[model samples]
Target: MLILKIFVFVTSAIYACIAKNIILIVADDLDVVLDGMTPLSSTRKYIGEQGVTFKNAFAAVPICCPNRGSILTGRYQHNHKIFNNSLEGGCYSQTWRAGYEKNTFATILKNRMNYNTFYAGKYLNQISITISWHQY
Candidate 1:
């Protein structure tokens, strides 16, 4: 299919250059030992075999919202200060509006490195309504 071809072309292009693409997939509420995990065999075969794996990697924040923010910004929760999930006091409208949207690693890659970034998944916790989604 055309989508598959496009995917291959884009991925190949990304890997071909010195400025490699950064693809981050964060799945929540999952706990499995990589050695024993079986459902994602295809992913394990492809990305696992051809890509890097971090057996000792960890999340800086246990909360979903904060963790996602940390990943985007490349900063610890303490530094980004997204202390809680989207909520009355600490959600997208309040925190992200403080300038994170423009300064994330996504933005850096897109704006500085001129990479094409794509995010296709769940958004952060409570700030969904106020976000002006950027390509980064």
Candidate 2:
């Protein structure tokens, strides 16, 4: 009876329609000002009233590559080991090793949770966000 119930639950979950798919959107160079110096007053109101605000959000590091990598990987920069910008002009990537797999959220989420992931930003760290995914 227990085994049957477990099987039923698992099967139901597998076939259950996704009510609302979760979308984690992180925008780099967004100049997110949750405090004061924000020019996006209208956006602030929208995000303030309708959004799930996180006041104590702190990046692992100030640097983009390492921090974005860390956010994706769920691992610290030390763990993934991307320390500095490989690029020079701060426009595009200049890394010697650029085959994805730096330290990012999409890679970890896709690899672990098997969820459909999408990234749109400056992707010149060590990974690209062009990944294919489906529930079928």
Candidate 3:
């Protein structure tokens, strides 16, 4: 089972690199039990069965905003400086509008790699509301 899982993960990564398109889904603060239940059942079935599962993956920052910042900028919260989910200072608006969005992996993919990126669901918590995702 472990070997099969590794094979699947490696294969999916190779295919993604070859295709130059990647879709990443991050569910914040959800219970692990959801993997065995309804709604996400199909996602588990398809993606798990076909793609890869990083069962032991770790988050850079456990909180929603900072972690999402890590994902967007590929930098840790210290560098991105979005310490928490607060809409106030040192948070989403300040961090993003301060120009962290320009050099993200997503922008590189969209501009250089010719990949169409789509971000769905909650973004940096409340700061998501203030910015236009289209510009990213």
Q: For this target, which candidate reaches the highest TM-score against the unseen true structure?
A: 3
Tally clashes: model 3: 0
lDDT against true structure, model 2: 0.56
Off by over 4 Å in 2: 1-20, 28-37, 87-105, 108-114, 125-129, 132-136
Q: Write the per-residue lDDT of candidate 1 for residues 57-103, one digit (tens) a residue.
A: 78888788888878878888777767786565354645576688678
Supply the TM-score for candidate 1: 0.65
Q: Give Cα-based local distance difference scores for all models.
A: 0.68, 0.56, 0.71
TM-score of each: 0.65, 0.56, 0.68
* Model 2 residue 52 CA deviation in Å: 2.8
lDDT of 2 at 41: 73
Model 3 segments beyond 4 Å from truth?
1-19, 31-39, 127-136
For candidate 3, give the lDDT. 0.71
| Index of the highest-lDDT prediction | 3
Candidate 2 lDDT by residue in tens digits, 12-119: 587555535667656555455554426657766887668866657778978877776566557676765667666542212433234335324555556655556655
Candidate 2 TM-score to native = 0.56
